[model samples]
Target chain A: MTERWKRTLVAAALGLALLLPGGGIARADSWQDRVSAGSAAATARGTTIEIAMLDRVTGQYRDNGPAAHTRIESASVMKVFIAEHVLHQRDLGKKAVTQTDLADMSRMLRASENAPANRLWVAYGANGIIADIKARYGLTETGPTSNTRYWGNTMITAHDMVVFYQRLMDGSGGLSARSRDWIVEQLRQSVEWGDGGRQFFGLRDGLPREQVISQKQGWMCCVNGHIYRHTSGYAGPDNRFIVVVLTREPSGRGGAHIEASITAAVRAMFPEGLVPRVQGQIGEMWVRSGGHRGPLGLPNTDEIPVRGGAVQYFQGGGAYWSPATGPHWVIGSILQRYRAMGYETGRLGYPTSDEIALPGGALSRFQGGYVYWSPATGAHAVMQPILAAYAAQKWETGRLRYPTSGEIALPGGGVMNRFQGGHVYWSSRTGAHWVIGSILGVYKAQGYQAGPLGYPLTDEVALAGGAVSHFEGGSVYWSPGRGAHALRGALLEAYQAQGAERGSLGYPVSDAYAAADGTRMDFQGGSLTVPSASSTTTTTAPPAAPAPGAPTGAGTATAPVAPSDGAATGGDAQP
Target chain B: MRPLRPAVAAALVLLAATGCTDAPPAARSDGPAPATSSSSGPAPAPPAGEEEAQALAPLPDGVATGTAVLVYSGLGELREPFAGQCSHDGSTTRIEGTADTARIVLEVTPDGARIDLDDGGVRSSSELSAGRYEVSGGHLSLRADMTQDGESTGTAELEIDCGG
Candidate 1:
């Protein structure tokens, strides 16, 4: 074979790696083969554990060990079949299943109340139910106990239990829709039983509330000198699964072990080995997150297909999984960015955290970076130097708040991030510098680089009770007392002519405020006013006059001739 | 699909943020210009020199209290209206409204003014761009444009006395 073909064959072989018991990854033959291996592994350390699973979506039925064929005494779970038979009788008589009957069924199914079960068994005729279930529902391995007095001893097989659940969902068990629903409703009640009743420890114990089976439990101690623990019910969305677990343990203390084994097997069949419980505020947000004509709603499909052993797809988004990072939601634009970065296989690796709520947006942290989303900014990834800078600034709680725009390339090839409070500009020469407060306000108002003050030459510099920032044109000074003021043009020249801040005028009290008289800059002691209309002498001055570069009270005054470049170095200069 | 917009769509003259489809001619806020049904009528000039309401009536009982449902019209379309509140003191006036799923708070004072709006939950505030307040004939009308950060969202016109 060619080298490329050899590599492809090796990858295919690795993709088929089966997660076998005892922490071994064995190459599996197929999905069913893996299921068989898992079943064998589960039964090896047990006495007799039988499990039956039905995938309603694909109409596939699989049984492990002696679960399908072996007949075992159905303890209280037989109450479900008995109630079904009783409801069928009522349906045949064209009679409504009364509220009292529903109450009795609830007691029988939910609480496993023996009084109602015996009453219903006798009312429907114990032998007649067995014959009806066998003939009508085609359940071959189900029959009433030989001793009618012990109604709980009815023989049942895993196959018959699965069939019974199937008929309930398909509405083919000779029971009306209302009657069937009433029985199912009863099964859903009292899922977590108290006071040492058979607690929901089988199929229901291992799943989330939304995905747990509405199941019935059957436990009978010392029945034929063996303890029985069984749980069977329909689970998943729209009752899309029927799972049956029957264990005949030597001692009654094996219920926990039985539950764990069955849970493990069920999880093996699903992606991430866990269901996305989608609950509470997150559920409300997801179901109604999008506006009209937007792409958001409840899950459109029941199966969250496992792709590449990690990522699972839903309607709006999906849950990604990994051994290191666990599982987290990748939704909307964040999901878009994650996919663009090649998902978990790329630089972001696996999502190590769930979508966390921010003030105006949400973020999901990953191994390498984080994806943040806001209605205004959509979603974008923050990684490496930019992310590190944000973290040092305390992320969202700091001055930056949330990123208003992603890290965009500036016109001159530097990088910058626009945030709610300010902007972070980065270049190889300057590392990452934050521009905020009134200085940022002035910079933004001046149309950034597109306006007079090109790019910032230095970060904010500290002065006595104030701070100043240097730009291409001049500097913006800010203080708690004076706000922020920009000094350039003739204003800078006039201020420097009087020894700047040490002279008559203090640090600029305001940026240039317009007035009818002229654009004025206020100072601590007095004010320097520039005339909107120049005097006749200045107007009539010759070409060699200092009129263009001087700080006279004239409208035609220009910037002062000072330093060679008129730009300061990037440093926090102390006053 | 949204409807096509004409060049100069006639707007329902309202207060700064309040809007009503059928504001009667008599419902005109304190203004000098007569209420004209034609869309091309000149904007009523702001209350000239002595036209500002003297007593100001303390804004009526619950006019500035509780919530006022207001509709916002801009960019040639009338968005769905929502409810908010407005309040005024002697020196400052504040009009708060909700539009496009955002809370807009307009605060105008003698010295400085600001208008804040939310994009998602992050608030964006900017200096008031332009404002015209007229209290003519015991009616208060306000027309103002709002700018958040540096971008202009839209204008709001309200007839304050009509409890809009």
Candidate 2:
């Protein structure tokens, strides 16, 4: 096997170097020629390797090597046959299969544990099951050694092993479906055993993770002073073929060579050895992240090329593997956020969608809480409440527009966000509500609840030509034609007596523009002049007292010159 | 309504029509704009003396003016929104504004009102950021750096609103 491997490597190298010289004429080198050329060196050293292959799909097969038909020591490969025979007995109710027996079968096939093989050999009537296997499977060269208790020393040829595998795969040869399935399932989980259990050599190591190989390996030292290392398996994405390689290493230095030789031989025979290696950084990442061992498991297909990088599909959300920054998982609303942020290289970077389950709903962290989307909210951010308030009053869309800022915490535990339309204030008490248009402007000028009027007690209620929001100490009344104003104390009573926005005095124009008498609150038609303390009288006059200074009329409007004692009522309280 | 000064008003009409915030600087210096202007023909020279060149007439009473919005590159660079009234306080014009919690300053000279945009490093106008503006009657268009494939790469904008 070692000699054959060296020759194949040399020939493969020659095939490449000969490519340019023999540019047009294709060299059709048969598998036999390749094998024969590779075996010359092994023949000189008296080491012979035998191989038998069965194409389960086409039902055609081939066998080669000096000992191809010669019976040799079976080693642990006999365990596979033993396991099959026991399963058949269990199926026919000749012997009941226990959970412990199944566990032993796993240990035997996977780790090549000997105790389970011996126990099953005894339990299933050893030689009787062996004879049954030989007669039913038509395995001409398979039989126990002279030592009746030793199943490891059972003799078998490569051809007989291939025939046995074929029957096991086809669910024939006197075995039930449950028996074949049990045997194959155990064989598929073969772990590294010899060489301190770190060696995943032979056919298993040679193939990539995408291909499924179910094989039993045999290794024993000093059998007639010859080292035996052999691997026989059914492998392919669909387990479409069976291969048996038997090796007798007298010198003990060529186990790896034989494995490599068999790997190359199978590649030459099958053509598609394994799925083509996935390319790029994402591919490299997949391999690094435990290829088939991680939660994502094996790639079902090749790395699919994408916008910035590539993706390999798996059972879970496949790794958005990349070379640049990270190869992370993307799932759920977090996935929506990542896509909105432009996928991998976007501001959110690679989506590490580690969804920490929140008390209600889930949050996938990203580059920005700047844009958060709840299924209930769609994608709207702050300030919609403010716009919705104005919108209710027929404010034109985008006419009263964009938000000036994100929601900010107010002094009294309420939250306020300003927008082109107006402002939205949210409290645990009043929920989220809006204040906009002229009424909003008046509310803002009155130090926004820190003034004579405290936090809003009610949503704006519409009047004839305007809207009004009642506050802790006052009411902000607004009219389109007259603008917004705060009417409190004597001023509010006078304004209420005259009606409201549709009153004889009209909507309050300025908040409280100061007058010489004291503080004068204006209206579209007149003014409510709260007299100085010395006079103690409130007078009503036409809007001609103090000068209307600027368009945004500057005023020291002191809501009747009284310091309002309204509580900071919006703090977590129901308004 | 307050009456606008005749001289300043005429210049303002052209400035407003063109959205010419960086006009005087571009017109005076041998920058990218001046070179392009010179390439079209010869750029018009400035008024002779520096003081005369810098001198600007007082804005009409009750009229709102310029706002200073800053622009800078690199990490940790702050940007305050341009919002408030651009007022003249005798020799030096002090225009203070606020956007949300951000304090904005509009630095005005006789030549024009401009916010000192700190670009952080040496960069041409082509490498600078695009800015947003809310001006009364001016068309303020901002351009930013383009990538190797001719796609714009910078995220920050150079906002300059000449509205009070």
fnat, candidate 1?
A: 0.00
lDDT of 2 by residue, A236-335 (tens): 6567657777766652443344444444444443332343233345445555554445445555655566766566665434557544535654445545
Worst 10 residues of 2 chain A by lDDT: A560-569
- Residue A508 lDDT, candidate 1, scale 0-100: 64
Residue A366 lDDT in candidate 2: 37
lDDT of 1 by residue, A1-575 (tens): 99999877754442222111111123232334434644565566474666665556544455663455578778777888888888888888844667787788787788776666766677777777778877877676677676554565678877678777877777866778988888888777754542124345555544544454588887654333345567788776477767776666553333444445555544443322323333323333333443112243344343343543345456667666655665566677888888888887787888887677888888989888878887876777776666777777788787666776666677666676766656666666556666676777666667665457666676565554456667667777665544566777766666667666555455565567665666667765456656666421111112232211122232323322111111121121111
Highest lDDT: give the candidate number. Answer: 1
List residue ranges in candidate 1 displaced over 4 A.
A1-45, A55-66, A94-103, A140-150, A191-196, A204-213, A236-240, A251-575, B1-164
Locate the minimum summed-lDDT window of 10 residues in model 1 chain A: A561-570
What clash pairs does model 2 have? A4-A38, A512-A557, B68-B106, B84-B97, B130-B157, B130-B158, B131-B158
Would you list the C-alpha lDDT of every candidate in the order shown?
Answer: 0.56, 0.52
- Give TM-score values for chain A, per-prediction: 0.46, 0.41
